[model samples]
Target: SQKIEQNSEALNIQEGKTATLTCNYTNYSPAYLQWYRQDPGRGPVFLLLIRENEKEKRKERLKVTFDTTLKQSLFHITASQPADSATYLCAFNDYKLSFGAGTTVTVRA
Candidate 1:
């Protein structure tokens, strides 16, 4: 069986700082990992995706790193703002899409 886990507690960070979130998985080797942001009552917005062979990927102020050796992924938001505050989710696909519980980020201005 495969399992994914994210930070169980909400993350609180000051505006203009970077926020980092972690996703860990067990018993699965996914081809790629994806990150998404979900605002209250809205569907998740795609952020970044990193492949198993890739070490790192970036898009605008977002960055993602994939480490198949550790079966973990890291999601980063640089110079985060209040608008960036949302529940971030990490998902991966082996045969099917699997998702973490998601970590809520609150960027205080």
Candidate 2:
């Protein structure tokens, strides 16, 4: 069985600072990992995706790192703002897609 875990507690950070989130998995080897952001009542918006062979990937102010050996992934948001505040989710695909519980980020101005 595969399990994914993210920070269940809310993450509070000051605006303009960087925020980092972690995703850990057990008993799984995914081909790729993806991150998404969901607002209060909206569907998740795709952020970044990193493949197993890739060590790091970046898009705008977002960055992601995938380490197969450690079975973990790290998601980063640089120069975060209030607009960036949302529940971030980590998902992976082996033969099927699975999602984490998600971590809520609150960027205070």
Candidate 2 runs further than 4 Å off = none
Candidate 2, residues 47-108: lDDT per residue as tens digits? Answer: 88899999999999999999899999999999999999899999986666699999999999
lDDT of 1 by residue, 63-101 (tens): 999989999999999999999999999998666668899
User: How well does each candidate superpose onto the true structure, as a TM-score?
Assistant: 0.96, 0.95
lDDT for residue 41 in candidate 1, whole number 0-100: 100
Clashing pairs in 2: none
Q: Which TM-score value belongs to model 1?
A: 0.96
What lDDT would candidate 2 get against the real structure?
Answer: 0.93
Tell me how candidate 1 scores on lDDT.
0.93
